[model samples]
Target: MSEDTTQDSAGFATRARIDTSRPHSARFWNYFIGGKDNYEVDRELGDRIKEIFPGLVDVAVTSRHFLGRAVRHLAGEQGIRQFLDIGTGLPTADNTHEVAQRVAPDARIVYVDNDPIVLTHANALLTSTPEGRTAYLDADLHDPEAVLRAAAGTLDLSRPVGLMILNTLGHVADHQQAQGLVRTLMAGLAPGSHLVICDGTATSEGMIAASEAYNASGAVPYYVRSVEEITGLFDGLELVEPGVVRVPEWRPEEADDAGSGAPVDAYCGVGRKA
Candidate 1:
C-alpha cells in the first residue's frame, strides 16, 4: 500500500515528499537492514558508510533484535497492551505491533514519524489484530507534546503505555533537549508505563567514523552518545535487570553467546515510570 497523500493544516503533504535526490534516515536505515524501500542515493550513502564501519550492519540488525526482545518482554511478561513507537522507521519484520500483538492479540499501538516516505509506506504499518487497533501519525520528535496528544486518540494516556524510542533520539542534536523530550512524553503517561530506548553509541572508532560520514551527507545528523549519557535518560525511572547494556547483551534468550563478549555499537534498556 502507498502512503496517504492527505494534506495537513500546513497545506503540505502529511507524508514526506519522496526526494530520491537525497538520502533519508529511514530509507538509509532501510538499506542497511537489507530492505528494498530505499533508493539508489540511500544505497550509495549506506555503502560509503559501510566502508567506514562494516559493523554498522551488525549495529542495525542487533538494534532491531533488541526492539523485538523488549516488546516481547513487555507484552508477554509485563502484560503491556499499548505501545507508542516514536520515530518508527521503515516497516521491517517483527515490528513493535507485530511482536506485541503476537503475544497479546489485543495490544494497541500508535506509530509516530515525520518521514513522508514512511508515511507513504504507512500501509505496511497499519496491520493490527482484530482485537486491537493501530494508527500512524506524521509528526516530528521535537514536538513531544503534539505527539502525545495525537497518540492519545488511539492510546489510553491514563493507562500504562510502552513508549519505544529506538534509534531516533540522535536526530536531536542537543542531548539535554532529547532527554527533555523523553521526560515530557513519559510525564504524560500513567504510572507503571514503560520506556524502551536503544540507540547507537560512540564505543568504537569505526562506528564514530560512519556517523560522521552520514552527518556530512546533507541529511539530518545523528549523534552517537556515550553510554553514561544514554543511561541518564532513565534517571527517575526503574531500570529492568542488567540495566543499560549493549543491545545484543540485553537479556539474550539463548546461551549461544552471540553478544556475550562481542562489543556492540549500540546500548539499550527498559525502564518503568514510577
Candidate 2:
C-alpha cells in the first residue's frame, strides 16, 4: 500500500515529492468512505481512529451527504453552473460534479487535490454529462492561487462558482492561515459565488481522542477547531438557512432516513458571497 504513482490521463499532473510512506488525509478519508484509493497505512490509521471515535465514520459519510445537498442547492435552486471544489477528496458517490450535473446538465466543475491516491482516482472524477464538463487539478490546498489559476482553465472565473471545501481545512494547523486561505479563495470568485464548508470539530472527548491518536500517526496532523472557529470561516457571507449546524441537520431530503436533528461530531454550512 504505497503511494499511488499512477498518472492522470485526464491531463492533470501532480508535482514530484508526494511521500507515500506517510498516510494522506484524503486517502484515509477515502478508506472511511469505502473507496479503494487508500494505502494500508491509511486504513490502519483510520481503523485506529475509528476505534477511538466510531462516530467519525458517520461524520465522514454525512459530510459527503452535506456536499451533495449543498451542490444540488447551488446548481438547482441558485442556477450556478461552475464549481471550484478545492481539497477534493478521493472519488466517491455523489461528488460535486455528479450532484451538480444531475441538477443542471451543463454545469462545469474543477476538482483540486494534491494526493497521489486522489490523482490515481481522478479518472472516476472525469466523468461528466455530455452537456457538462469536469476536470481535475493536482494542486495543494496551501497554494490556493495556483489552484484558482488551474481551475480558471476549466471554469469561467467571472461567473458565479460554488466553492466546496468539505472536511479539508483541518490540515492547516494555523487557524488564521486557514481562514486566510478561505478568504483568499473566496475573494477570487464573483459576487454571486458561494462557499460550502464542513469539517470535523473538537466537540466531544471521543473526537478529541481520535484527533490526538490521528496526529500521533505518521500522517500529517489535522486539528479539530471549536464550533465558533468553524463558523468564523464564513464571516462576511450570508449563511443559508439553518446555518453552520451539524452536517446531518443541513436541509436534508425527506427520503434520507437519517434524521435532521441527529447529532454528529462535525459542522457544516453554505454561505453566499453577497
Candidate 3:
C-alpha cells in the first residue's frame, strides 16, 4: 500500500480500538483523578457514580496518594531499585517511575498495560533520570510469562523488584483468579522482591452500589472485594507493618490533609517475598 494509505489505515485501526461510545476503566479513573485524557462518556459515568457514592472520589484521590508513599518506601527504606508496574493506568502526576526515581535516581521501571490509549500516552511515562531507565510494554496482566519476558528487557528479574498492581486487578472478576495471577507474577520475581497492591473494597453499601453502577455502564467490570480477599493477595509474602488497611492509613505523611487519614473504600499494603 501507499504511505498515505498505510497511515490512514493505522489511524483507523487505532480509532476503532478505542471505543468512545462507552466508558473505559482507565479513562474513567483518569477523569476521577482530575485528568484531561477522558471523553464525555467517561465524565458522564464518573459524575453519575459520584452521585451514587460521593466517597468514591476519595477512593480515587487517596489511592493515588498511597502510590507515592508506597514507591518512596520501596525505593528508600527497602533499598529496591527496579519496578514492574502492571495495570498502570493513564499517566498522571507522581507515576510509579517518577516516584521511584525520585527516591532512588538509579531506579529502573517497566510499566505494563494493553490499553491503546495508555500506549498512546506512554511517552509521558517514558521519561527517566539519567541513572535510571523506563520502558512501556504493551502486554496484558493475565499472561504472567509474557509480561515478565518483555519486562526483563528493561528490568533485571533476578534482582528484587517492586511489583505494583494498584487499582488494576479489579478487572479480574474472580477472586481466586486474581489471587492466582498475583501469585504467578510474584513467583517470577526474586526472593527480596516486594508486592505492592491497593484496590477498592466492598466495605460499604455506597461503594458497592457505585461498583454495580459502573459495571452496568458497559465498561469493563471492576469487582471490589472484601478486605480479607485483598489481604489474601499477599499470602506467601511477609506483610509490611500495619498490614492491609485503608490506603491513607497505611503510612500517612505529615503533609497529607486531615481528610487523608479518614477511612475510604480503598485498601492497600506492601509485602516482601521471603
Candidate 4:
C-alpha cells in the first residue's frame, strides 16, 4: 500500500502521484483478483461489493480465464503475433503477454492504461521475450488514433493484431461512444485482426445490485449492459465459434474444477476483423 508513482522514461506515465483517497478501478480490480497492489480502500469496496453480490469474485476469476482462453486462441490457433490490450488492469497471473508469449514466443504485446498505478507496475509488464516486445502506454482509450500512433513504435499496424478491451468498456458510460471507440480502433488494424471483449452485465438481480452499489461508491462508475447490447459491440466482426457466450462456456479448460455451473453475469466474445 505504498503510494509510489514512479514513471518510465517514455513519459507513458506523468507525474508521480498516487491518490489513495478513494478506490480506483485498477486498484479494486487488483483487490478482487487477489493481487497485493491495492490499498485498504480498494479492499473495503471490493468486500462491500461481494456482500451485495457474492458472485463478483467468481466473475473476476472467470473473466481472467476468458482472457487466457481468448489470447490462446488468437496466438496459438490464429497465429496472431501482435496484441493491443487496452484497459489492462493490474498485472496478474496469465497476463496477455504471458499467455500469448507462452503460446508463441515471438508474440508482441502493447498494454495501454490511463492509470498511473498501472504505470508503476509497467516494469513488471514490460518484461518480454527476447524474440518479441512489450510496451505500456499511459494513454486514454477514447482516443484510438493516439493509442495507435504511440503503439506504432512497437507494433506494425499493417499486420494483424489482437485488440483486447476486456472488462474495460463499462467504464465508458456513453454506449454510442463506446461502440464508436471500438470501431475506430478496429478500423485502424489490418484485416483478420481480432477483437476480444468481456464485461459484466445486468443479467441477475445480484449483479444489478452489485453494479448499483459500486456506482454509488465514489469510484468511477462502470455500466453493465444487457446481453444483446454486449453482443452488439462486435456488430461487423466475424465472431469465433460459440459466439458471445458466457466466459466459462468459451472453450474452457478440461478440468474437473467446477466452481459453479450457474452462469455469471459477465459476457464475452472474440471476433476477427475480416
Candidate 5:
C-alpha cells in the first residue's frame, strides 16, 4: 500500500498505468460523485460541461442511486445472487458487489470494463467479503461472448443474475450496436435473469448541448439516445414495477434524497427475462 502499488490486503495491485493528461470517463464520473480520484483535465472538462448543463452532476448522482436501488431490488425481492456489472467505474459508494452482498452474504459479482484506469483500480473493485466473492474482468462490451466466458470463472450462468448496465451504454455511440450488444448479453443468461439499464437521455436542450461539448473534448463520444431507443433495449424482457422511468423515479430508498426528486435527463428500468 505505497505509491508503487494499489495492492489490497490480498496483495492485488493495478497493472494498468495511469495517464493523467487525457481525460477519462471513469475518473470524470468519480469526480462528479465527489471522489478525489480524478485529474485536473478531467475536472476541467467536467466544469465546462457543468457550465453548459448544471443538472448533469445531478444526473450522475441520481443514476448511481438508481444502480443501488435496482441491485437491492434484484438481490432482496427477486432473490438473485449473481451480478454482472459491465463498465464498472472506479470503486465508489454503493458499488454492485457491496450492495448485493449486504443483502445476501453469498452474492457473487463480476465487473467488466475496457478502461485502463478502471482496470488499474481492479484491486478496489475485486475486494469482497468472506461469504461472497468479487472479480474484475479486463474486457469490453462489444464482445459479449468473451465477457460471459470470462465471467464464468466467478459466477454461475445457470442461475439468475442481475445484469447491470448503468450509465455505460452511452459510451457505445451506435444505437443498433448497443441494442445488439445488450441482446447478446441477455441471451447468454438463463431464463429469469434480470436486466438493469440506466443511461442519460436526449430529453432536454441543455443535456444535448452538454453532450456535444463532452463529445468534442477528445475523449470517447457518448451518445445520449431517445427514450424509445433506451426502452427498446429491453424489448424481449418484462419490465418491473415503475418501468423505464427517470433515474430518480426508480424505487428510491428513503435515505436517497436525490433519487426522490424531479426527473433528470437520465432514464432507467429493471426488466426480468421471461
Candidate 6:
C-alpha cells in the first residue's frame, strides 16, 4: 500500500473498456496498493481478503519496494540501459522508467500489459526523461514472440535488457508453460540480459487461505508456488546474491530492511543470462 498514485484520472471512465461486473486481479492489486484506479467490486474483495489475511497488504507494499531496489541495481550496478517490463500493472510512483532513469537517464524502457485498465492509464507510465525513452505495448505475455517483436520498435533487442515480470506469472496456471514463456522471452534478448521475477509463494497456511479466498471471489485465479518452484523459474540464469529469498530481503536499503524482516509470502530473484 506504499505505492504513490500521483497520476491524474480525468476522463478515464470514458476511455477505459473495463468490466466492472467482475473482480480483476489488476484492479484488486491497485486497491491493495492504495491506488484510486479500482472499482467497487475490487475494493469489496480486497476488504474481504484483508479480513481473511491482513498480511497480504504487506506483500503488496513490500513487493513494490523490491521493484525499486531491483531497478536501481540493474541500471546502476549492472549497467543495463534497456528494460522490458511485462505485465506492467497500474502506474505508481518509482515506476520502472522512473527508477531506471534516475540511475541512468538514458535508460530505454518498454512496458507491456494487456489489461484495458492498464492501457487507459498507460499515459502515466509513458512519461520519460529527455535522455531516455518509454513506450507502452498492449500485448499479452502469453505471446512472447509478439511481445518481443513489438517491443523491438522501442528497445534494441541486440543489447542487454532488464527483463522484468513481477507478480504476474501466477496468472499462468501451468508451471512448465510459464517457464517456457519466460524462456522464450529471454531467448530473444541478447546475452547479459537479466531476468527479474517475483511472485506470491505458498509459504504459509494463512497465505494459501488468502489465495483461495481471492480466487473464490470471482477474480482471475493467481496460483502461488513453493520456494523451490520459484527458484526453478530462474533455472539457466545466474542468480544474484541471497538468491530467490523474500522480496524485502533482496538488496534492501538500511531503512527499508529495518523492521521488514518478518516473513512475507512472496519471493523474488534477479538472474542474468550468460
lDDT of each: 0.89, 0.87, 0.92, 0.89, 0.89, 0.91
* True lDDT of residue 267, candidate 2: 95
**Which regions of candidate 1 deviate over 4 angstroms?**
1-16, 255-261
Q: Give the best candidate by lDDT.
A: 3
User: For residues 1-274, what per-residue lDDT tens digits would candidate 4 score against the true structure?
Assistant: 3334332343442434677888888989888877898889989999999888888888888898889889999998999999999998889988999999999999999999988788778889988999989999989998999999999999999999999999999999988899999999999999989999999998999999999888898888999999998888999999998999878888889752324667788999998998
Between candidates 2 and 4, the lDDT winner: 4
Report the lDDT tens digits of candidate 6 across residue range 107-175: 999999988888888999989999999999999999999999999999999999999999999999999
- Pick the TM-score winner: 3
Q: What TM-score should be assigned to candidate 6?
A: 0.93
lDDT of 1 at 271: 99
CA displacement after TM-score superposition, residue 144 of candidate 3 (Å): 0.7
Per-residue CA lDDT of model 1 for 1-274, tens digit only, reads 2244333432355433567788899999988787998888899999998788888888887888888889999998998999999999999988999999999999999999988788877889899999999999999888989999999999999999999999999998889999999999999999999999999999999889999999999878999999999999998999999899988888986722343345889999999998
Q: For candidate 2, write residues 216-243 as lDDT tens digits.
A: 8878888999999999999999999999
In model 1, the Cα lDDT at residue 200 comes to 93
Angstrom error at residue 14, model 4: 5.3
Error at 161, model 5, angstroms = 0.8
lDDT of 3 by residue, 238-265 (tens): 9999999998888898775425344699
Candidate 4 residue 30 Cα shift, in angstroms, is 1.2
Candidate 6 worst ten-residue window by lDDT: 1-10
Worst 10 residues of 3 by lDDT: 254-263
**lDDT-superior candidate, 4 or 6:** 6
lDDT over C-alpha atoms for residue 224 of model 5: 97
Query: lDDT by residue for model 5 over 1-274, one digit each (tens)?
Result: 5754644422343433566777878998999999988999999999999899888999999988888888889999999999999989999988999999899989999999987788766788777889999999989999999999999999999999899998899999899999999999999999999999999999999999999998898878889999999999999999998899988887877777683245599999999999
Clashing pairs in model 6, backbone N/Cα/C closer than 3 A: none
The true-versus-predicted C-alpha distance at residue 123 of model 4, in Å, is 0.6
Q: How many residue pairs collide in each prediction?
A: 3, 0, 0, 0, 0, 0
